[model samples]
Target chain A: MAALSIKDLTAIAKKTKESMQISAQGPHTKITVHMGTCGIAAGAQKVMDSFKEVLEIVDKKDVILTYSGCAGLCSNEPMVTIERYGEKPIKYINITPKIAREIMKQHVQKGNPLKEYIIAKGYENIV
Target chain B: MGDSTMSKETKKKEKTQTIPDLNSVPFFGRQILIALRNRGRINPESIDEYIAHDGYQALAKGLTKLKPTDIVEQIKQSSLRGRGGGGFDTGRKWASAAKATGEPKYVICNADEGDPGAYMDRSIIEADPHSVIEGMALCGRAIGSTVGYVYIRAEYPLARKILGHALEQARAYGLLGENILDSDFSFDIFIKQGAGAFVCGESSALRASIEGNVGEPTPKYDHATEKGLWKKPTVLNNVESFANVPPIILKGAQWFSAMGTEHSKGTKVFSLVGKIVNTGLIEVLMGTTLRDIIFEIGGGIPDGKAFKAVQTGGPSGGCIPESLLDMSVDFEELSKAGSMMGSGGMIVMDEDTCMVNVAKYFIEFCNSESCGKCISCRDGSEAMLEILTRISEGKGKEEDITLLEELSNAIKEASLCGLGTSLPNPVLSTLRYFKEEYQEHIVHKRCPAGVCKALITFTVLEKNCTKCGVCFKNCPYEAITWKKKEIAVINQNQCKKCGICYEVCKFKAIERK
Candidate 1:
C-alpha cells in the first residue's frame, strides 16, 4: 500500500545492475552445457535441447556443446558454463527455459557471459 | 624426480595421448577381479559388451550351488579390506550384518564417493554396474536380505541413469527382485541420490540420506551393520569393496590375496593425475612402489620439471616427499608416514607447484565443503585457509606457521566426522615435508615455485634477450614495449608475471623472480 519512491527506485536500479552484470560477462562463444548426471536429473537435458534447437534454427551448429563433470554444488544442477573470446568461463546455475532464452538472446546473440545466474565465477582464479 | 612420461606419439600430434606398454608395469594384463577387469576395456553403458565378458557368471553361480556363508568364507579368506579409506575388514562387515538382530535385513552399496580428486568408486559405478549388483546379490543371499540401495551422488547423473537400466535388466534376468537367480532368496535394489555432503560418504550418514533425512552425519556408534537403514540390519560396503566380492567368490580367496603385500592383498586402482606428462587411470598391484607408478605407468612429470610431492588419498591423505618416492604403497605404511590410503587418489606435484599454494588449495576445499556441523571443522578450516592465503600472499609472519599447526591439531582432534578429523592432512603434510618452502614465502618473501602471484615478479634480463619478439606477442596485458635502441623491455608494474612470455621466448629474455 506504500507509494513508489527513491528507495524503491534505488533497489530496482541495483537489481538491474546486478542482472546486467550477469548478462555482460564476456565475449563467450563456447557454451559448455553441464550435461552431468545432476544436470540431466534436474532437467538440464531439456535446457540443452532448447539451446541446441535454438542454435540449429539459427544455423549455429558450430557452437560447441561440450560436457563436463559435476561442478560439486549438487543443489544447483543443470549448470551452464559460457565462455567468449578472451574471457573467463562463467557458470550459470539452476538454468531453466525462460532464463536460458534470455541468456540466448541477451548474451549468446550479443557477447555477454551472464553474471547474475552465476553460482561460481572466475574458476581459473579460484581453482 | 625424473620424467615418467612415456614416449609420445609425435606423429599424431592431434591426439596428444601416449599409449602405455604393459610389460613396463607389474601387473599389466592380468584380470583377477570381475569388477575392475572390465573397467578400462568396455563402453560402460553397453550391456551387450558387459554380457559378452562373463558379466553375470557369478550371479549364475550364486543361484546354483553356493550358500551365502560360503561366499562370506571366500571373502574372509581373500582378507579383503574396505577400499573406502578405512581398511575395515569386509568379510566381518558382511557377517555382522548377517547376525544383526532385525527382520528386514538390507544390503547397501556406498557409492557416495565425495573425496576430492578420487573417482575410483564413480568410475566403477559408471563402468560396471553388473559387477556391483552381482556382489550385492551375493551378499543379499548370504544375509537373507530382500532389498539393496545404491546411495550414489546426485552429481553422478550418468552413473544413476546407467545403474537404473542395469537394475531393471538384472531383475528381468531373475537376478534381482523376489527369488533372485530362480532361487528362494529374492532381492531388490533402488537408487538414493545424495546431495553432495562430504560427510555423507560415512556409513551412518549415508544410511540417513537413504531414509530421506538431511545428509548431516552424527557419531551414534550404532554400528551401521547392526542398526542401519530404517533401524534394521543393513550392510553398507563401498563401491570398490563390494565390487571385489564377485571376484573373491569366483577366483577363491588364496588367489585373490596372493598379489598384494603381506598385509594389503590384491590390486588397487589409483587415479594417477598431477604435473605428469601422462595422466590417466592405472590399476596396479598393491606391493608396487610409487616410483614404478609415476614412471612406468604414469610416464613421469611433464616439461622436465622436478618432482616435488605426491598427494595421495585426496584431502584426507598426506604429501610424501621426493625422498620417499620409492616407498611401498600399502595401507599401514602410508598411515605410518602420516598419511592413510583413503581411496587411492594420487596427485603428483612438480617443482613449479608452490607448497603454500597446495596447502591453500586443500584448505579452501575443506572450508567450502565443511558441512558446518562442528565448530572446529567450520572455524579451524577457515582460519587455516586465511593463514595460508596470507602466507602465500607474502603477508605472513613467522608465527602464522605455528598457528597453522595448532589449528590443524585442534580440528583433527575435536571434529565429529572423518571429513573434519582428517581435514588437516594437507596442512600437516606440507608443514612436515616442505617447511623450508613456507619459510621462503615468510622470510625471503619469494615463491620458490614462481606460482604465488603476490610473491613473484617478472623482470627482463637484457643479457638473455635476442630481439626475437616472441615475448612481445605472448604478453596478455601488452606490457612489453620495444626498447628504443635494443630488444623489448618489460613494464614491471604492468606485467602480470603469467610466465607465458618467459615460456615463449626461446632466449629467455623474461625472468620470474
Candidate 2:
C-alpha cells in the first residue's frame, strides 16, 4: 500500500474495503482472525486458504476474514472468530488448515458450533 | 515542465495512500504518547522517517508556548508516574528539578533497563530513537534543564547508535540546540554508555556511571531531584516514563485519565514473554483485566496446559498465582497481589513451571546482578541463593524454609538500596503463595514438575516401550539399554537428564519423575 498525501485515510480504507464486499450467506457475520506477525507466521495464511477452499466446495463464500495483531501469545496462531447470524462471535484458537476445514464444514455450514473449539464467546451479538 | 509534471504525478500517487501515523488500536486507543508512540513501528536508523511522523512536534511545542512550570503543570494534571518501577510522580520530579535553586539543572533518561524480561524501554530506543530524543527535549523544556544524559547499556549497541543519530538530527533541525523552535529555549542531550551493570538501573548508580565512576547506587534519601548528577538538580526518568510525557502535553490529562483506572491512567506496555502463547510486546490500557491479557490476548497456555502462575515485575517482582487472574492491572492492584507492575515486564507461566525452581532461577539472577555495594544485598542474596539452590536440588531442610523467610525479611529491611530491599520479592511471594511446593521439594524430596535434576529420575515404562532402539540412539549419554525385545531399561546411574531419550521416542515410553 502506498502512503496518501491527502487527509481522511480511514475513509479511503473503508471505501476500498466496502467496495470489495460480497453478498452475505444470510445476514451480518463478522469473521475476525488473529493476524499479528507471529499469527501470520504460524500458518494463518494456509488457514485462511482452507476457509476459502471450504467455502468454494460448499458454494458459500459469504464469510468475511478480518485480522488483529498478536495478543502476546505466540504459541496460538491463526485465531479465528466466527460470528453466526443472530449469535455471538466465538473465537477458535490454534487454527490450522485442517482445523479451519472442520470449522467451516461443521461449525459454519452445519450451523451447530463446536463448543470445545470455542475459546472465547464474545458478548457482541450478530444482528 | 516534464520534471514538474512527474513530481505532480508522484504526489498524486502518494495522496491515495497517506494515512495518519497515530495508532488507533483499542488498547493504545487513548495513549497520548510522549515516548512509546514510535516504538516497534519505525526504523530507528532512518532519520528522515522520524521527522515525517511529527517526532519533534512536542519538542517544538515545548520550546514555544510552555515554560518550565507550564510543562510541569501539564504533567501534574496528567498524573504520569515513573515507569522505572519506582511509581514516583513524573510531574513532581520535574517540578522539583525546575524549582531547584542551582547553577545547572540536569535531565537524565535511565536507559539502563536491566530487568531480565523488560525490553519495553530498550525496544523503543532501538525502534524509534527520535521518540526518546523528542521526549528528552520535552523533559528539558519542562524541568528547565539545558543538558540531558541518556545512560544506556553497552549490550544495546543498536539503541546507543540510533539514539546518537537522533541527537544529531535534532541539532541540525535546531530542535536540540540554541533557540529551539525560534524560541528562548536551548537544550541538548549526551549519550552515556553503561557497562552492563544491573545496579546501573538504579537512579543514583546510573548517575554515578554518567560521571565516569564505577556503576554503583547511592541512597535516594536526599531526593536526587535536588542534588543529582554532579550535585546539580537532576530529573532522572526511565525510557518508558519519559516516552509518556509528550503525549500528556499534546493531549489533555482528561484524555489519558479516561483510558486507565481511577489512579493508574494511560496505556502500559509489557514485554509479554515466556511460557505463554504470545512472546512479544503488548501495550494495553490500564485496568484491562489480567484474565484478558493471559487468556484472550495471550491465547491461553500452550499444549492445553493450565496456567499455574505469572511472574510480573521481573527478578524483583513476585509470582502472581492463577487465583488472581481476574485482577485488574494497575500499579497498586499488582502491588496488593504481592507483585509490582514493575517496569512492565510480564512473563506468563504455565502448570509446567516449577514454583520452587522458578523462585530459585530468579534468586540466582538477582545474586549475579547484585553489586555487593552493601552487606544486606550481597550477603543476603548469597545466603538466599544457597537455600533456594538446596531446595531445587532436593537437599533442602524443612527448617531452611523458615530460615529463608527470616533472612529475606532482614535483607528487605536492612538493604542499602531498592536492589537489596526488593531482592527477596520473588522468594517471599513464592513462599507465601506456594509454600506446599517448597515443602514437597524439601520434605518429600520431589519436584512435581519434574524440572529439578536432583529431584527427578528417568524411567522406561515397559508397557509403552516398543523396543525400537530409538531411545538408545538418541540418548546423549547412552543411558538407555535393551536386553530383550520385551522392554528397554534406562541406566539411572548413567542418566544425564538431557531429555533427548524422552523426545526421540516415537512411543510415549520414556518417563521422568
Candidate 3:
C-alpha cells in the first residue's frame, strides 16, 4: 500500500463521512447496538441479530446499522439507540430479542418510539 | 421536501413525549468524554469510521506541523500525569527519554491491566484502539523511537484481537509503519501478551517480561526512562494515558488542563463495578467528588443497601468509608484519604460487606501475587494474610491490629517493587477507617455484617417470614424446610451458611446472627 499524504488522510475522512450520510444532511435512520464485553455477556449479539432480521424484512435501504463498545451503563446492557435523521436519538435499555424486534418495527421503521423501554433521548455532550 | 416535513412532525412528537434527555440524567450528564470520545459512537473495527471522527488527525498534525521537541513541550505544559496510578508527569518521562543517551529507545504501552476488578484498559483497547495507537505514534515522534510494544494480558483475548486488527489497519493506511502519513519519521508498534502474573503490571517486571526474562521487578534505582527494555531508554505509559495524548495534541494543552484539578489535569476513566446500580465504564473530570461519582453518576449502591465503603484503585488501593464520599477524586486527594488512584477501579461495597473479610480478601490477593523477591513482601504479606484470616474467622487477638500495622509499615519500607509497597493499602486503610468494625469482631466475637460464616449463624425470623417459602426454594443446601402457610425452619445441622438463602429472602425473614 502506498503511504498516504496528509491531504489523503483528510480526503478519506471526508469521503467516508459523505458515504455515511445517505441524505443531503444525514442518514435517514441510524441504529447502534452497544456490543462491549459486558453488552455481549448480556446477549447484545442476540439483540443485534434480532435487529438485523427486522431491518432485512423491512428493507429500508437508507437506514444504517452499526455496533460500538460499552456505553457506560453496563447494568442496562443489551441497549440499543435509534436515531431518525433530524430527530433526537432515543436510547432503549434492558433490551431483549423481542424488544429489539419491536424497536426496529415501531421506532426504526414506523417512526414511533416504544416509550416504556426508552431510557433517555438525544446524544451525550462529547468533549 | 417530504423528509423535512417528516422530521418536523417527529420533533414535535418528541417534544410532547417525556423521554428524559441524556443531559437531564445525571448518569450521562455528569461525564465528560475525552479519552472515550468515540467509545460508543463509532465502529471500533473500522478505520474509516475512526478517521471520520478525526482520529488520526492529531498524529498527522504532529508529524507534519510540529517537531519532536515541540510535541514534548506541549504535553509538559498540559500537566497530564500518568493515569497508570503513579501520577508521574508524562512529558517529563518523554523529555528524559528524548535526552537520555541510548540508541533504539523504545516506547512501551502498558496494557497489562491486572487489577482484579479493573477493565478500564481492556475496554479502551477494545473500544478505541486507534486512539491509543495514535497516542503511541505521537509519543514515538516525541521520544524519537522507531518501535513500540503494547504488553497486554493474555486473558483479554478480545481486546488483543481488536488491537491486533487495529495495528494492521493503521499500517495499511500508512498511519503506523514506515514513513507514517508520508512524514520523514518512521515508527511501528508490536503487541506482547503477558503470562497473567499480577505483578507484571509493574513497569520493570513488564519490561523484563518483554525482554524474555522472568517477570519479576528489580529495584528502580534508575528510572525506566534511563535504562529499560534491554537496558535502552524507554518511555512507558498506561493504555489510558496513551489514549489521552491525541486529544491533547489536537485540542491543545490548555483545553485539556482546563477541565481537571490544580495538580491533575484531564479526565480519568473509571470502571465503576461491584455493588453499584450503574456498573460500567465512566470518564469524569479529575477532582469530581466521590459523592457525585457514586450517587449522581453510578446511581448509588444497588438493592437499597446502605453504603459502607468504596474501594478505589485495586487490591493495592484502599477502601474509602462513607465519610469521605464528598471528597474530591484526584491523585493527591485519593492518596491523602489513604487510597491511591490505581488505574481507576472503583468497587463499591454495601453494609453487608465485612471490613475484616474485605481486608482478608485483598491481603490474600497480594499474598498470592507477590513475586517473593524480597523477604519483607513475601513473608510480610503471608503473615498479614494469616492475621486477617484469623480475625475474619473469629480467632484474632487484641494485639493483632498493632501487629498488622507494624507489618504494613515494614513491607512498604523494605519491599523491592510497587506490588509489595502498595499491597498493604487495603489493610492499612480498613484498620484506620473501620477500626470499630475490627474491634467488634475481636472483642465481641461477632461479625456485624454477618459475612464471616464462622462468626455468624443463619436463622429464619418467624414474624417476618410470612410463610413465603422463597428461602426454602432458593436454598442450595436444602437446609430450609417449610410447609404450606408455615414459617420456614432452617436445619442448622445441614446448613452450609452459604448466604444464598439470606440473599434470596425478600421479606427480610432470614436473619444472620
Off by more than 4 A, model 2: A1-127, B1-35, B39-41, B483-486
lDDT of 1 at B489: 82
Cα lDDT tens digits, model 2, B1-513, are: 999989876764453223222132222222333345554223455545555555555665665667667878888878888888978888888888888878678989988888888777766776567777777888888777899998888887656776798788667666677777667778889988889989888888888889988878887777788899998899998888777776666666666667778888777878777777656666777888888887766667888988888889988899999889999999999999888988989888887789888888888888999998889889888999999998899899989999999999999989887888898999988998999999999999999988889988889888888888888877778787775565888898999997888778878888988
- Top-lDDT structure, candidate number: 3
Residue-wise lDDT of candidate 2 within A4-122, one digit each (tens)?
21222234435544533433544345455554435567887788777777667765445655444343334455667677665545667788888888877766766555555554454
Query: How good is chain A of candidate 1, measured by TM-score?
Result: 0.68
Q: What is the C-alpha RMSD of each candidate to the true structure, in Å?
A: 16.6, 11.2, 2.4
Model 1: per-residue lDDT, tens digit, B359-470?
Answer: 8898898899887989999999999988999998999999988999999999989998888898899989999999999999999999999999998888778898887777
lDDT per residue for candidate 1 within A1-127, as digits (tens), equals: 2322223334544553342232333222666665544456788778877787687766463354445434333345677777654544556778996777777876667544455676443332110
Candidate 3 residue-wise lDDT, B72-128, digit = tens: 999999999999989999999999999998889999999999887899998888889
Candidate 1: segments with Cα more than 4 A from true spot:
A1-127, B1-34, B46-48, B483-485
Candidate topping DockQ: 3
Better of 1 and 3 by lDDT: 3
Predictions in order: chain A TM-score: 0.68, 0.68, 0.91
Per-model TM-score on C-alpha atoms = 0.75, 0.77, 0.96
